[model samples]
Target: MFGDMMNMMGKLKETQKKVEETKKRLDSVLVDETSSDNKLKVTLTANRTIKSVEIDDELLEDKEQLKDYLILTLNKAIEKATKINEAELAATAKEGMPNIPGMDMFK
Candidate 1:
C-alpha cells in the first residue's frame, strides 16, 4: 500500500509538469476571428489575451455598430480559443492516464 501511494504521487507530479508545459504552450496559441460581415477582426491567444484588432473604416463611423461588431468578434475569438484549449487538454490527457474518466479532475 505504501508503494502504491508513492507511485501515485510520482505520477501526479509528472502529470502536473505536463499540464504546466501544456498551459505555457497554450499561452502562445493564437486564433483569429472576424465578424459575420468581415468588418471587424480580432486575434486571441488561447489564454484569452487579445493580441490584435482591425476594424473596417465604415465601422468607425458609427459607435454603436462598431461596439456591436467588436463584441461579436471578441466572442467568436474567445470561442475559438476555448476550442483550441480543449483540444490541447484532450491531447495531454491521452498520455499515461489512470484509466478513469474522472481522473483528470484530480489533476
Candidate 2:
C-alpha cells in the first residue's frame, strides 16, 4: 500500500512538471481575432497575453467605436485563448493521471 502511494505521488509530481512545461509552450501559441467589419484585429497567446492590436485608420476617428471594437475583439480572442489553455492543461493532467478506481467520472 505504501509503495502504491509513493508511486502515485511520483506520478503526480511528473504531471505537475508536464503541466508547467505545457504552460510555457502555450505562451507561443497565438490566437487571432478580428472585428466583424475587419477594422480591428488582435493577437494573443494561449496564455491570454495580448501580443498585438491593429486598427484601421478609419477607426481612429471615432473613440467610442474604437473602444467597442477593442472590447469585442479582445473578448473573442480571450475566449479562444481560454479554451485552448484549459483544453491543453486538462488533457495534460488527464494523460498523466494514474489509474485510480472511481476516477472515470472526471473524464
Candidate 3:
C-alpha cells in the first residue's frame, strides 16, 4: 500500500509539472483576427488575453460604426481564442486521463 501511494505521488507530481508547462505554452500562443473589410483587428492570446487592437483610419469618421466593428472583431478574436483554449484544455487534461480514447488530437 505504501509503495502504491509513493507511485501515485510521483505521477501526481509529473502531472502537475505538465500542467505548468502547458500553461506556459498556452500563454505563448497568439491569435490575430480581423473583421471583414479591414474595419477592425484584434490580437489575443489563446488564454484570451488581448494583446492589442487596431482600427482603420477610415473607421474614425463614424464612432458608432467603429464601436460596432470593434465589438464584433473583439468577439471574433475571443471566440477564436476560446476554441484554442478548449483545444489546449483537452490536450492538457488528457495528460492526466490517459484512458480516454479519442484524445489523440489533444496529445
Counted clashes in each candidate structure: 0, 0, 0
* Regions of model 1 farther than 4 Å from truth: 99-107
Best by TM-score: 2
Reference-based lDDT, each prediction: 0.83, 0.96, 0.81
Worst ten-residue run, lDDT, model 3? 97-106
At residue 38, give the lDDT of candidate 3. 74
Model 2 lDDT tens row, 43-96 = 999999999999999999999999999999999999999999999999999999
Query: Per-residue lDDT tens digits of candidate 1, residues 5-70?
Result: 787778767777887899899988889998878889999899789999988999999999999888
Best by lDDT: 2
Model 1 deviation from the true structure expressed as Cα RMSD, one decimal place: 3.0
Q: Report model 3's TM-score to 2 decimal places.
A: 0.80
- Candidates ranked by lDDT: 2, 1, 3
Pull out the clashing pairs in model 2.
none
Which residue pairs show backbone clashes in model 1?
none
Clash number for candidate 3: 0
Candidate 3 per-residue lDDT, tens place, 29-56, comes to 9999998897688898988999998889
